[model samples]
Target: MSRRPPDGEAPVVTAIVVAFDSAHALPDCLDALRGEGIATIVVDNASTDDSAALSERRGARVIRNGRNEGYGRANNTGVRAADTEFVLIVNPDVIVQKGAVAALVDAAQRYPDAGFFAPQIVEPSGRVFFQPRSLLAKHLTNPGGKLVLPEGEACAPFFSGACFLMRRSFFLDLGGFDEKIFLFYEDDDLCRRIADTGAALIYVPQARVGHGRGRSSGPKPGLVFKSRWHQAWSRAYVSRKYGLPDPAPSMFAVNALKTLAAGLSFRRSLIERYGGSAAGALAFLRGRSALRQEGLS
Candidate 1:
């Protein structure tokens, strides 16, 4: 992490990109913001790849963690370092569309009661993901373009996690995302809290961000297991924190059956999904809020 700013680094909005071995997809992300005067902060979550250096070369302020601090915590560090009024939190795999930052900033006036602004998120497959419909749908499986908001409906209860712009003060007041979530549902926890405060989470289609799905976790058995376990743990914790009726027992039953079927059919991804649900149910039983680093290290 830099204690000193690199020369005269002046940016209108501080954009924090949380990276974990993200060197492969980072270039395109940075290129989209070239000369945009966005104070880019790349918080490298103990990535072994050259992510920090690559970001530094692109004039981004780099914060290299000694070890992985998870997504929410890493973004918190960048938010703390930000001096700008506006802050954009993004993942390294996200490509910001032209004028997106400005559009989000401009839309802030239209939504005077908003706590944050989310842009249209397009997947590599040309599909929409995590749109406003996802606020209460409670994703049971791959959301894969399942939710859509009509052209006129702009106010949303919640927004996607990949990219969003918000007032720095609003984020600080919420104490940022709950770090206890570790790897998943941190956004859900934060967004719901904002809604509870009677603040709108507006979705602006004019501002768009392209997302490349799941670059960090490749399709491997062990990694998949790690992701599933954490996903389960986080979902359970979020449900409890928000006072949503516990779906643990039902999730466990359905997923256990799915896991058995997937195992028989050799569907590794589905197997992991079911395994995650089972693991989450166990997490709910244990009242665990955070997941310990295990095979992932």
Candidate 2:
């Protein structure tokens, strides 16, 4: 039988934290969720470490996958397992502040038309990126700061995917995140889909999450190459999907070419990273839909 939240009571929320070799960060993340009055599910993406064990130790239900599934698919696994109407999607490195979940619930109650609600995303260093670098850089920073009209919590032009509350029914109706994307641009796709449906995607500053940035990327050099590749590929894919003009490489590309012209004079690290990006761009131009190589979560 389908479960429904009781009337005149706190609405049940299932907090889904996707983990991949995240044992180092799971304790603090799961600890903050404790006593938040929400059931927790740690979706372990076949982590090599003891992420599943740590989550179980923290009293969160664990759904361990046998293979290494990427972000969107893993979240889809947890979302399907959850019975609550509200699902809180957050990264393993994010710490939900006091009243954050409640504030989102309160806003959901207030804004009945909003199917999605995003809270304030603050870095662990207490800084907020208001002015992000590029179109793709904005995907990493704040999404709706410039969308302020009269200055208040309203339907955002877009919202960060780091931590947010979403209506389960509407989310399922939209077919969840596109699994073709291994890592990047899935959140932007979600926000775009919500906006396309004419449903509200509100940004509630009252709620907040402290994100320990860079913790999500396992700090591995190979992962860095994978990230750059997916970043370039996803940007191109999203641009095409939304009927936008083709996304060209950044100004740094000119420098890359200049360095190549000058007898491979650029930093070895820059060349290595840009090499993956160049390959991804070529794949996008060739009309490839999925990543051919595997990437770590």
Highest lDDT scorer: 1
lDDT of 2 by residue, 79-191 (tens): 99998878999899888888889899888888878879887888867775222222432233454435223245755556667788988887888988888787777888887
Best by TM-score: 1
Lowest summed lDDT over 10 consecutive residues: which window, candidate 1?
133-142
| List of clashing residue pairs for candidate 1 | none
Candidate 2 Cα misplacement greater than 4 A, ranges? 1-11, 129-151, 248-266, 295-297
Scored against the true structure, residue 76 in model 1 reaches a CA lDDT of 94
Q: How accurate locally, in lDDT, is each candidate?
A: 0.77, 0.75
- Model 1: per-residue Cα lDDT at residue 155: 69
Please, what are the lDDT tens digits per residue for candidate 1 over residues 42-121?
88988877888999998888988888888898899999998887889888888888787778888886676789889888
Q: State residue 64's C-alpha deviation in candidate 1, in Å.
A: 1.3
When summed lDDT is taken over every stretch of 10 residues in candidate 2, the lowest stretch is: 129-138
TM-score, per-candidate, Cα-based: 0.85, 0.84
Q: Which stretches of candidate 1 lie over 4 Å from their true place?
A: 1-10, 130-148, 216-221, 261-271, 293-297
